[model samples]
Target: MTSMSKSKTNNGNGTVDSRRQEVQRIVKNACDQLNSEGVDARNYVEQLAWLFFLKAFDEAETRREEEAAFDDAGYERRLSGNFAWSSWASKTDHPDEMLEFVDGKLWIKLTSPDPKKGLGDDPLAERFRR
Candidate 1:
């Protein structure tokens, strides 16, 4: 059987890097576990990409709020409800509900053609549109 190779990185100053190892270990574990349950490896990776995109966008929205970049009231009103990652991803009361949401409303918003409304020209949303 093949062994998982340890990940390496350099600080550009020639040193053993542990950061890469941690991320590699995390991803390897997730993929291994998911694949064992008959999940296609590629699909698992794609779903992970979606999650990372949402988390990153949520963070960016928070930054924009702090900077007063968007219409404050409007921004809060837009995301503070079911539209926010926290609500659909973490705070959902049931697993099935979250699944329905991820495949439904979330998908719709990311792919919304009305650029002036949902996600509105956001590059990350475009990445998740598929």
Candidate 2:
């Protein structure tokens, strides 16, 4: 195996190995569920990747905002309010509600940017616009 793969799969700790296995199992279960619904592995993985990307972006933006606040500097957020993952994902309790938000509002916000609607001209938002 490549050194990178080996390093990732064998971290020289039983606890890490067990946790890795658990994560793998959870991802596999998710993939299986999507597959059962006629979603191909590639499509499901891409969707998962998009969700993960948005979540990570939100976390990084939060950190940057905090740092700017501490320094008494202004920090413009790329995602906030309902566009933020924390707000939409956590606040929407029901599956149907979440789906509706994603399919309707979230999709429009991401795919069709409108400065008038507050999906501003930030770098990340501009990328989505393109």
Candidate 3:
């Protein structure tokens, strides 16, 4: 029988690399979609933050529901009307106010360590920083 050589593998490092690539891919896709929709390419970073915040909020809510019985009051308490892009955009006729609302939510989500309804650590915070 021929001798077999074993190849060493770094699963942990591979996992990290995989995750990094996945995040990059997601950001790229989001940017592409935004561009296709006629949004300014420069706004990709802002859009990324907004999408990330929405996704994180949805995931956190799902987790909460699975972990505990559904609580309408708790759900309502955690809801952030500002999370809705269209709603926030319409809040003020001025572009500055719209940008402010979006930026404010982005900052809150990025800084919060704990899951708070509309608040949580932004998953795309790293991308935004870059």
lDDT of each: 0.67, 0.79, 0.58
lDDT for model 1, on a 0 to 1 scale? 0.67
* lDDT assessment of candidate 2: 0.79
Q: For residues 47-119, could you state the per-residue lDDT of candidate 3 as single tens digits?
A: 5665667666666866775556544434331434555443454555687876776577745644454444333
RMSD of each: 6.9, 4.3, 10.5
Superposition error at 126 for model 2 (Å): 4.3
Candidate 2 residue lDDT tens string, 53-77 = 8878898999999999999999987
Candidates, ranked, lDDT: 2, 1, 3
Using TM-score as the measure, the top candidate is: 2
Per-residue accuracy of model 1 over 1-130 as CA lDDT, tens digit each: 2233322222352333554566578788988988899999767787887777677678787877776755454344234467788677785568798888878887876666545545456654555565
Against the true structure, candidate 3 reaches a TM-score of: 0.36
Off by over 4 Å in 1: 1-29, 69-80, 115-127
TM-score of candidate 1 on Cα atoms, chains taken together: 0.60
**TM-score attained by model 2:** 0.68
TM-score of each: 0.60, 0.68, 0.36
Output the better candidate (1/3) by lDDT: 1
> What total of clashing residue pairs does each candidate reach?
0, 0, 0
